[model samples]
Target: MSIFVRLLEAIGIASASAPPIASRPAPVGPIMAYNALDLSDPGLLEMMRDGRIGVSGLSVNERQALRNSTFFRAMNLIAGSIGKLPIHLMRRNGKLTEKASEHPLFNVLHRKPNDYQTASRFKSYMQLAALLDGSAYALKIKSRGAVRQLIPLARRSVKPQLSDDFVLTFRYTRPNGTVVTLQADDVFHFSTPLSLDGLNGVSLLDVAADTLGLTIKAQQAAARLLTKGTMARGALQTEATLGEEAIAHLKQSLAEGYAGANAEHDWLILEEGLKANAFGYNAKDSQLIELMKREAEEVSRFTGAPRPLLMFDETSWGSGVRELGLFLVTYCLMDWFVIWEEAIWMWLLTPEEQKTFYAKFNEGALLRGSLKDQADFFKAALGPNGAWLEPNEVRESFDRNPIEGGEGLPRSGTTAAAIAQADKPDDKEGSENGA
Candidate 1:
């Protein structure tokens, strides 16, 4: 621990030893409940507007509004590469015979699913990201150029930053070889960046968040490689804490909201379990990511697209549900901070720089935040008796909460919770499904 602390001190990062303490105290993610804040808060509304979040690249407020919007949910469904409707659903003589039924408990969940194909999911997501008016945008993104300069810098081996946002940043280590440290500026697009050199700053928080995200993505890929064909083991474990934190945060919001029910003081920042910012990764996200990567690779093999993934920006799709007197907006940054790191690393990032970027950019934030919405959907479906729900009843209550605002996700919170508890401090899950 002392040697690790010293290395981080070399990178001009001093708060190295204390980040863990700060993370533990963070409030959990909020729950969806009807309140006026849904309509009043510009950030929440912005998330409702666009279907995707640009993270640092776009306006945070607008992204917030876009998250609560129903339009994005409709779009996300149709963005699949092949087609929207399941192949089985589109059989030769299959007709739209049966009208989709609405759930009695929640009126919103009964709505018909939408499927609009997007031109380029990522770039279209970039359009949504354009909403961020401040810095975090850039041009002439020649990854090759950044790698050329940064890779050599890694070999020199200066003092490590020791921040939680490190690869070696987050329970990482120096492989027994020449070290190469590379920082990603792509996620750090600050419009009209200070020097006009397109260079913005890297906060310890941002770096930490990025590391978590990268860890999830890379670890997911690794898991896919490690497990032949089995349910994702790693994801289940990490989700335990992730779910607990989320529930705790939401419950706090409920208390605040209930306490001030008659007053205008409607919202407060829910404590986040994720320690880092945008690229933050918790143990649970990594576990699931391990499973997701294999799912992604399987898609690659099946589609022959080299690598293909059915991406869902659940966190950005929409906000909390609002009804007659109740207006709920679960303000969770549960959206994927960065998806497809392997593709990003292989195609966008250089070979040499892949190590650092993979561990850094994505790890800055947690991969899974959409769990809040799933929980919300369950609460909504459970009527006013969410607390009394039984195990199967819980499953039944969630006839299926679509991802964020889309299709049915993993079916039950149990599955999601199990995965969240799986991520380790080092983000290294045991090889349970060692095929």
Candidate 2:
């Protein structure tokens, strides 16, 4: 009785222990990472709209680099967002001007003329033109220094000694535990006009249909918003109601629960991380900037990458403007690997399309052709891990180039060029070997 019965029980136990051979799909364990954006997931594209996802911000340089790559369109979508500042302030105080675009104040900042500048500077000037449409910018705070009057309005500011050097700069940590050092002058580049195709991972139609049916819904809501006043254009309302709708669309797309926004949530987590490293929150000082600043020390480090000490001659808004968060957005969109991974609206492209994608993502071709020495400098900015710059070293290096505007030019065109040259070597060696 015992031996046969025991053997049968053992067999039963063994059968139970093994995985079910051909059963219906069973529930898996909890999801721990950014699987919402996973392409293999059945509803990935559809989920992109349903408030379960969002696109991340891409930088200016990276966006342009991947403009023609497979991910370019998706990146544009991820990066586009709406920021709601006290919108009333925009009406009563801010002017409707193309400050960054047509009237980019950076163009007013002169540099020692060179081939790169003569060519590249014009491109920046055009960028300002595209963004602003030529409107005078309001000077937020008048900086003064004896160097203020330098010709071409070089970065020399003529600030009275009385003005406190209050804007602080420091290094911070990101959610992924990466380091990003930020200077006080680093601009947040709020979700103003996120029209560039930086977010190519998900489709806009998919996002609109999902997140509150937001694209069309936002347009309808913004169109209906009673809130309106003097805008920068000297118009009688806040941004054209449609413009407000677009921004709202953008902001909601980035907030928690937006599909493809797993990266953004991670970034915010990084910002909060700053709280552990330094001064405690004053909670009492409720100023928005102060509130934001309370979070800033931490934010700076979380998005931290090494700032390169570029060889330009400006400081105020030059290399010091664009910080680490923005750069991540830029690089991710233009990154060769990421773009190549998502080829053609989920269809996967042929080999020829991959070639074109690689070419566009490789900005080195343009840089090397224009400036050899400058290409070398760009190579130096790249970190050992292929990052545009090291988390710690970036701050000081990019400071050297002439900072015109159009997402603010780097001081070192040479640095950018240097990286480009190394990325793609000359085929001259192959020719020599053949000979």
Candidate 3:
């Protein structure tokens, strides 16, 4: 009977048999029509203004926060680093493990998850959503009792519901006004580490909204200073008082003569005894730059990204860059990797399969050093003193095809003849008598 119920009914969510609002669980809260309804509707606008609808009341908008250069760079750096890495489905056989390439889900994870998106693009999109919106979701399209495709769902459009029986479901409102209720097993959900109730994750953006607001405000102030600040190249001053009409005319004349890129080098003509005074960079301007830098540092700290990776500092080509890369992997990416792996086990793999199968993000690419350093590492791995890595295994790391007889580990000071001679049993009497 209420406007909210009517709106829900109009969107094909509420029906005659639907339970009354008071009877529903309290913690589920009101179903927010986030961008699902016509926002231009006056009734909707009224509800939003009156706080009847739970539209995002973020102090800083998520999209606007991304517009900041430092925030964008930090997000891109973290998301891209996770995206570019290869995620594989691996099976453990005792102490040995190998890529489960033959599994149906393996291709979905490694190469293509769906028809429209590659693994990299899909992972990147999910990572961005998780970082920005606190959670990410994908509907698992299954075929023949196995997952076939993963369709991404908008974070805002999907509402999570948990019942008293500990069962979970998702009420997803699509763009076309259709509402679909999905089971917990049918959706792949990834949440941020900061979860209070253990069912939903807290948004990092929302948690750091005040800081992001300051960053956005600082950026806007800098823009205003550049466009309308008194630190311009020069300004006109007059000793004689002038009428409003005269002042308007002088302002128009100055703008027409020297406003844009075309008038940058044009000479200003002095009229009515007006004098021009040049301006230089002042302490205030320097302070603004420092303020922006400090805000960037704050954002970097929130994202757990190193300042160097965010382009705040200059890292040399070899070791400096390598160390930073390692730091990023250890501090920032490792947790994300574990999150994805555990989520995959929970949502993608079956109970029996989870015992032997697992997902892993191969971060070797990000942690790789220079060519020489890699060579030395591989050399040490394949060394004779208790060689743990096979020649073919090292080649596989380099993306080279395995060669014949490369599976076995090599030993130093050992040749085919030496091996054959060593294999032969020696007669002690023959050796001592020189027979």
Candidate 4:
């Protein structure tokens, strides 16, 4: 079997038997049609041939890319951010909105998505898969016309097919090597915004292969350097021309006596008036730190994560933590939120429910600041002057239970009873005020 086929099998994707290229049908719809000759499809051919190998000669598939620290950190930042936030199924009643707790999807999205995974964990896994593979798929197991459980599928295991009439089908390979074709409504697909054919999302790993490859190479170089005790290659100079035997003996001596970490500090013992002349650049000369920083920035740019969040000491868009966090939410996570919300509406909500019910990630928690700042914000929200939020609303934000009579917005200072008696309006003024 080919390495590509092995890789596919390793990831639970079963490769189909190939027919002759001449007998294959023409490309149709937005999906890339594959002929018996995989080489006919440029994208698939590239993946099979190059396996996303970079200029640095490093393979940069999703798993390989995640091995880089910067890439892993960025993925974790995005996935964790989406995971920790609460998602709600909200219902709209004219101008008012409230959580649709009675909806079947409410518990599946907010509390537990499946018997084994909590909502947070499922979201994190899905987000991570989407970020890595450019698309994430989950089976929407329904009961009584309502989705009851969501089972995530391996990205490689599911193949999407679009018919000429715009019907979508998913061919999924189970762990037991069984292939089952499912309709559009049976699957929940979330893809990144960048797409050429609309039906499938492009993988970020493939797009940023060169950058990530260089990063992995740089990391390997650093590891090798550390293993060699930060040593640089040098030449042993001698006035006398060395014979082949002498050179071999000298090379062996260097390798056995002074090559690795244990012999790093050992003094070189040279004979016959030989001198050590350093030639190649050391880690400092090569600017490894600067290279790593550039790679980190590249990862941040590609993953839409702030550099500061990746543990870079430099200041990002804002100086304060709250501003930086806001930057992350607004720039990095908002698109993902929209993707999830729209996907939910598309796959989970019925046509009648779509008009009134929608999904939303409550990002208010991520935007919150320190305790003092939160207190001031709640106070202002519940203040008497044009009070917009009830006391119970503020308490709910803090995860506190509502007290009796805390549901109403208190217009204390603005009330007629609180107004000064001297400032009280006369009969005509009072009538106008009441009007």
- lDDT measured at residue 30 in model 2 versus the true structure, 0 to 100: 44
lDDT of 3 at 142: 92
Query: Whose TM-score is greatest here?
Result: 4
Q: How many backbone clashes does candidate 1 have?
A: 97
lDDT of 1 by residue, 189-283 (tens): 22211122323222212222222233344544656655754332221112224567776766676566745548455434434432322324444
- lDDT, candidate 1, equals 0.31
Candidate 3 clash figure, as a count: 0
Ten-residue segment with the worst summed lDDT in candidate 2? 82-91
Q: What is the C-alpha RMSD of each candidate to the true structure, in Å?
A: 31.0, 31.3, 9.9, 9.5
Candidate 1 residue 137 Cα shift, in angstroms, is: 16
> Candidate 2 on 2-96: residue-level lDDT in tens?
55344334434224455443463644864323332244754433233322232322212222323322223232322221010000000111333
Highest lDDT: which candidate?
4
Candidate 1, run of 10 with poorest lDDT = 324-333
In model 3, the Cα lDDT at residue 182 comes to: 91
TM-score for all models, in order of appearance = 0.15, 0.18, 0.73, 0.75
* Candidate that beats the other on TM-score, 1 or 3, i.e. the better one: 3
Candidate 1 vs 4: which has more lDDT: 4
In model 4, where do residues sit more than 4 Å from their true spots?
1-51, 228-281, 414-435
Q: Encode model 3's per-residue lDDT on 1-435: one tens digit a residue.
A: 888788677656677688986887665655456544566755455334431211233356667778878889988988898789989999999999999999999999999999999998999999999998778999999988888899999866676889999899998878775678999998999898888888777776766676777776777777887788766566678999888998899889987887989987888887889999877675375587788778787888889987777786654444565687799999998889999999998899989899999999899898677787787676666655666778788888988999887777777664422343344355345655785
Off by over 4 Å in 2: 1-287, 294-337, 345-360, 365-372, 375-435
